[model samples]
Target: MVAHEADYEYVIHKFETEYYTYDPEDDSEVKPGPNTPDINPKDVKKLPSSFIPEVKNECAQIFYRFKCPGSGLFHCILTGLVFDMTREAELLYKIIQWDESVLQPAGKMAAGPLFDIKCCEDAVRQLHFPHCVKTQEALLSDGLLSVAHFTDDAMSFIKPLKITDTHVIVDNPHLSAFGLVLDFLMGIWNKQVKGQVLLFLSPPNHAKQTQNINVLLLPRNIPMTEVSKHHQPSHFILVPSACNLIKNTTYTVHCPVANKIQPKRAEFDMEFGPNYSPTFVIRLPMNTDEVTLTIRDQTDTEVWEHEADLTDHLPFSADGRIPAEKIMVMLLDILEDLNDEEFKKFKWHLKTEVWNNISPIKENYLSKADRNDTVDLMVQTYEITGAVQVMENILKTICRNDLVKKLSTLRH
Candidate 1:
C-alpha cells in the first residue's frame, strides 16, 4: 500500500484561556460577559473534554485529543461549521507524535503534550477544500488560530513515502510470474525503513465488490498463516489472459531439477502441446460441433476451472493428458435438452447455489451461458462438473431417470 503526501505531519494547536473556567463556543471559550477573560482551572467542568489543566506549573506540558466520527464528517458548534480530516490522517496519527517545543525553552526537556485551541474558531480545511470558509475567516479576523491555517502549516511539513499501485498482466506472455511477487516484496521491505505493509493476492481475473478481481487484501499486521491461505501456484503465472496460457506461464516450471517433460509443452500449439507443464494449447477440430477439455496435473489429479466463463477459452489441464472428448460428450448430452425451459431453471438454481457457498457473493467464475445461445458455445466454455450437475438434476426432475443414470456413470 502506498502512503499519501499528507501522512507525514501531526497537527498541533495551542489554546489560550482568558477565563479560569469557560464553556467552548466557536467565537469564544468563556462566559458571555463584558469582563476580559482569564485562565482559572478551578472551573474545570466547563472546559471541553479535550482540555487538560497544567500540573505542577509545567507550562511546557498541555494535553488535547481528537476523535474520528463514523460519518467521516466533522463539524463544529459555532453556527454549525464543518470540516473533513483527510484519510491520510490515519497515517499521521500512526507515525508521528506531539512535540512540546511550543511550551518549552530550547534547553528544557520537551514533554510532548497535546495542545488545545481556544475560541474553537480555528477550522482546518482538508486538501480538497483549500479556500477558507466563513468560520475560518472569523477566526483569522480575530487574530485567533483558525483550523484552516493550522492544517495548512502542519501539512506543509509532511513528506510521505511514495507508493505505486500496479497490476500484473498475466496473459501467457513471455514474463515469468513466479519471481514477480518475491521481488515486489523485497523492494518494499528494502526501500521503506519502517511502516505498516500489506500485500494483496487476488484471484485470477475475478472482480469482487469494490475491488478488482485477483487482488489480495493483505495488511502488514495480518498473521503470516492467514496470508499464506490465499496463495496458489497460479499467482506466479503471468499470462495475458486465461486463454493465452503457454508452457512458460510461470518460472518454477522451468527449474532444471524439477520434474521435466521430455518435450517442452511450449513447442506445440493448443491442439498438440504436452500438458506436462503449467499450460498446454489444444486445437479443437475446426468442424467439430462440441468439445470438452479435462486437464490434469503431473499427480494424475484432474484440474477443474471452477471459474470458467463464456469469455474464456476451452479448459485444459495445468499438466498431464487433456481429456477433451469426455467433457464434450457430457456437454453434448445436456445440449439435447436445450429446448427445455425447466432445464434452464435448473442451471439458474445451480449457479445460485454455487455462488452462495461463500458467505458473501464472490466473483462468479462459472460461465453464465444462456439456453438461447448455441449449444456449442456453451459447451466450449463451462466446466464439466457444474454444467453436468445442473443437467443431471434437470433430467431427474423431468422423469428422465434413464439419462440421469447414464450421466452418473460417465461423470469424468
Candidate 2:
C-alpha cells in the first residue's frame, strides 16, 4: 500500500476503564471526579471494576484492571488506546487464566477472560461510542507487524502456533499440486510469510459449522507426530494458498512442479528437450477434480496463472508401458520416501527401468487402424447403446412409456 503525500501524523490521547476488570469503557487509570463524565462500560454495569494498581514504580508499564457488567469484548490486552500509547513495544502476551474449581460456583453467573490485546500499532484507531459501541481502525504500516484475530471454535488449528489474533495462515495441502503455490508466493513480495499453516476444521475454520471435510494443518510448536490430533478439519473456507490463488473455491492448479531435478546429465533425458518433463511440471493432487501444477522455470511467466487444468493430456501410466510423465510422477512420490543415496540410485535405475518397460511393450504398440477400430466400436456399440439404455430407464420409471413413444417424442 502506498502512502499519499498529504497524509498527516497526529496523536490523540483518550482514557478507558472497563467496568469489569479487562473492561474497555473505563480504561482511564485516573478516576473521573464528580465534575467529570462517566466512562461507558456498557450502561449495564453501574460502574467500572475498581482499578487495579499499576505495577509499582514501573514507569514503562501503566496497568488498569476493569470488569464489564457482563462478558466483555475488550479483547486486546491493551486496545488501540494502550498499544499506540508507546513506540517500541517491548513484548506482547496473552495468558488465558481460568480456574476450573473456582467455577461460576454453579450459581447465578460466571465470567472468564477471553483475550488480551496488549499493544496496538501506531496505525490504529479505537472509536468509543456514547452508549458503548466498540469499533477499531488499524492504520497501515510499511512492514512493521500484522495481526489477525479469529473466533474460538476455529482456534485449535492456530493455538499452538500462538499467532496473535492479527496474523493469518496460508496452507496448501497439495503443494506438489501444480507449481501454483510457488509461482504465487514468488510473483509478489507479499509481507505475509507462511508461518505455521493450519489445516482448518470448518468453512471459515473446517469449511463452516455444518459441512464435514477434514483439513489437517500442523499446529504451531507441535511435532508432526502430534499433528494427528491437531489436524483440525478446515471449513469450506477457501483462501488461496498459491500466492496467485485469488478465488478461494475455483481450482487454479496448472503449472507442474519440480518432480525430480534431472541430473545435469541423464539418458532419455525428457526434461532437457521435450520442454515437457512432467518432472519440471509441478503437479499436486489437489482434491479429486483439480490438479495444481507449478512450473519451475519461466516456462509461463514470473507468476503462476490463477486457472489451470490438465485433464485431457493427463500423464497417467499408458497401456502396458510407464509414460515418461508417469515415471516422473512415481519418482516424485518415491523421492519423498527414499533417502538421498537410495533416491539417486533409484533415479539411475529409472532410466534402466524405463528402457526395460518400453522394450518389451514396443511389439504391442497398436496400429492406427487398430486404435481407430476400437474407438469406433466403443462409440458406435457402447456409447449409442448407453443412450438407448438411459432412455429406456427413464421411460420405465418416470413415464412407463414404450420405446416407440420415446422415439416419437425425440423425433418430434
Q: Please report the candidate that would top TM-score against the real structure.
A: 1
TM-score of each: 0.23, 0.18
- CA lDDT scores, all candidates in order: 0.24, 0.22
> Against the true structure, candidate 2 has what lDDT?
0.22
Model 2 ranges off by over 4 Å: 1-88, 106-211, 214-236, 239-412
Whole-model alpha-carbon lDDT for candidate 1: 0.24
Q: Write the per-residue lDDT of candidate 1 for residues 1-412, one digit (tens) a residue.
A: 1101111110000011111112334333212233423433333221211111111112222121234222122322111112233221221111012333421232221111111232121223221111111122221222111111124234111111110111111111110101111111111221111111111212332232221112111111112222222232222111111111222122111212112222232221111111112223222222222223333333434322222121222222232112234544555665565456655554444444331121211113123333422232222122233345445555676666777766654422
Residue-wise C-alpha lDDT for candidate 2, range 69-156, written one tens digit per residue: 2321222222211211112222232322222232223221111122233333431122111111011111121112112122332211
Off by over 4 Å in 1: 1-167, 170-181, 184-319, 347-351, 355-382, 397-399
- Model 1, position 122, has a per-residue lDDT of 21
Candidate no. 1 TM-score: 0.23
